[model samples]
Target chain A: MHPHDPEVTAAITALDLFAGLPASALDEVTARARVRTLGRGARMFDQGEPVERAHVLLSGAIRIAQAGSDGGQVVLRFIGPGEIFGSVAIFTDHLYPADGIAMVGSTEASWARADWLDLIERYPRIALNLITIVGRRLAELQDRVREMATQRAERRIANTLLRLARQAGRATGAGTEIGFPLRRKDIADISGTTLFTVSRTLNDWRRQGLIADDRRALTLVSMAGIGRIALG
Target chain B: MHPHDPEVTAAITALDLFAGLPASALDEVTARARVRTLGRGARMFDQGEPVERAHVLLSGAIRIAQAGSDGGQVVLRFIGPGEIFGSVAIFTDHLYPADGIAMVGSTEASWARADWLDLIERYPRIALNLITIVGRRLAELQDRVREMATQRAERRIANTLLRLARQAGRATGAGTEIGFPLRRKDIADISGTTLFTVSRTLNDWRRQGLIADDRRALTLVSMAGIGRIALG
Candidate 1:
């Protein structure tokens, strides 16, 4: 996408980070942005890479994950369209702790590190908006930690589905589909369980008609049922 | 504590959040601050309370935790001197999602919500610093989630103790002592395990001379051994 592309300008303006930024500021951001596209499964950035840019997802999704010492991986989050990531390192030390991989055809507008910091310094409101985003994510991660600590694997899985559905669900005849490819391993990572356990839980939920599960997508057939399980 | 308490003024001025603000702004902050003292185990704020203030821990520590559906609690972090909490609510809808309790006799300086927002608005550098604080915290929470998902209970506990030691430990003859009261329950909460399991792990570690564990404090006798465990 070109800097002057109308679509790019529109997306930048609509971002929560740009919610109240004046048109001149938004224009400057658009001017500084460099758009990059990724094919399905492309690596956006690798774990431990030097942080060079701040990314805003304009379309599609990316999975942020960390590899464990044992070669296992944990999915930190799935960045949907219009969300920001890869900026944390820019603000602190310049190292990406996790790998971000594009889950599908995706486009992101990123600013070189100097440019991003200069933008935030020039328009402090941008930094304020970022505080809100990071703060919210911190709160959500705390909830996830609590769920992993106190809830059973099945309940954790149920709650994870409920959360993702709330964030990315698309209404369909099947149910509220999560409109993204999610593997059993992804559920395992999010729920802090093993893939085998995740597979078993998914099978049980499918048998109970709590979810319409598949490799390509997951549909929550009974949110109330999931909520009941999540409550425990 | 008075608004002009030399120690309080010094602490606030040294905080990264208050960094680079003119003396006038700092003076304004000090004047508007309210100091509160909490005895050991006193709560700074209960979970679900209306978040109406931004807190700065001036002396002692605070434990940030959330109660789970099953009556279990997860200790999100131990905030020591110079750290900030309860400010996330200031930027959002202003509801505390978790409980913050004093881990010891603690003193905190807090700004009323409106006053704090006004200060940040007037001096955008304060807002910039808050973004850094929240951003760093988001990174830490992500690490915790990864540990819970991937590490065994023993490794998780080892990692937790190591982290606490690095953050709050005081060197002592017995070992590198964590200078605060930390019960097995705290370890259990931090490690996402049962108190029974934590006790057993402590006993095992004590037997191996890896730690000097007690009711009032814990001392690491073997940091390298514990590091090996955390590495797993």
Candidate 2:
């Protein structure tokens, strides 16, 4: 693997927020962060582990989850390329609150916590970028909370499918298919329901011609209907 | 009214993040921030209003809400003394997504947006502190979202009451009484339920000797029972 290749350099340079930073600042960030790779199903971090760095996804997908007291796991969120993870633990002075695991063939990432603190001290602009990033995530979480409170299970499922489709789906002539690897149980965790419920709901949607489910893949047959359901 | 008097000075100083700033920084922040006294029911800012500043609640309580499409309002959160509001709108580069109104007899607050940016430029420490603050709030929102998704209405009500009591309650011989000036509808909005549901569940708790409803007040008679319900 060309760990120090120019393509990686170009990708990092193209990030809008970091684009304006001087090469020296970027080098400082690069100096403190090390690139790592993980194979499919490999554990990236476990709940209650010491959180020393925040990971920025370079490629592939990661599932962030927390174990419930009832012997089940709850998926908090999914992190894809160009996104950051492990921040909540950094600020709270606690162990990582969730477990992160690779969900695809392979994944690559870079991380820095101590370096980030030093970088923020030297470049306040980075801190401002972080504030905006964290702030947007906060708004998204608030919207999700609102949805959970007000929407029915069917609507929530529809909305989840729409969101995932937008974030990680590949378009086909017939329908858009989500590319990220996921199981029915993972869908249930993310959608905040039971696997049985998720199966039943997917079956109902299939019968209604709203979606086509192939056990391992989901295709949206009627995006407009999903939107209507989400609104309802 | 001593709008910039010792009480306000002490409160602002305790923020720690702002305490070590240079005199010029403090002056800049103070110059742009206006102190306002809001009477009960007065709207601090409405949904879609341009967000110009972030408010620090000096005293009293404020409810932050959004108008639902169905002509109802959803209370997102409540801000008490020492807490900050308006960051969500400020960072998003969007108009206020929710409305903020005084929920008590009166509220005293100070706000500054432009000046705060200047302060961040002057003192990166303040930006770091602000990041920590925003991150903490994000964690709390995640917890609340998880609760809404997993918990039943009765448990939600119980947890909400317990949380409010801890935040802004007064102790009486009978029990801890939530002192915030909240209407039944406000509680319903905060708890993500209809007013009818809130009233019904509260009445059920009262009948079961789990809580005492004192019209504008609420007192927990069985904290253990409430904890059990919340944990379930």
- State in Å the error of residue B161, model 2: 3.1
**All candidates: TM-score of chain A:** 0.94, 0.87
User: Can you write out model 2's per-residue Cα lDDT over A19-70, one digit (the tens) per residue?
Assistant: 4588888766655666777888898888888987777777788998776453
Query: For model 2, what share of native contacts is present?
Result: 0.47
Residue B209 in candidate 1, Cα distance off native in Å: 3.3
Q: Please report the TM-score between candidate 1 and the true structure.
A: 0.95
- Quick one: best DockQ, which candidate? 1
Q: Give one digit per residue, the lDDT tens place, for model 1 in B1-232.
A: 8768898889888988898899999999899999888899999998888998999999888888888666867888888888897779767657887899999999999999889888888898898778777877887778788888887888888888988898778888877998667878878988888899999989999999999976677899998998888887
| Candidate closest to the true structure, highest TM-score | 1
Interface RMSD for each predicted structure: 1.7, 2.3
Residue B21 in candidate 2 has what lDDT? Answer: 73
What residue runs in model 1 are displaced by over 4 Å at the alpha carbon?
B173-175
Residue B69 of model 1, lDDT score: 61
Worst 10 residues of 1 chain A by lDDT: A66-75
Q: Can you tell me which runs of candidate 2 are displaced by over 4 Å? A: A1-3, A15-19, A70-72, A106-108, A169-179, A200-222, B1-3, B16-24, B68-73, B108-112, B169-179, B194-213, B219-225
DockQ of each: 0.69, 0.51
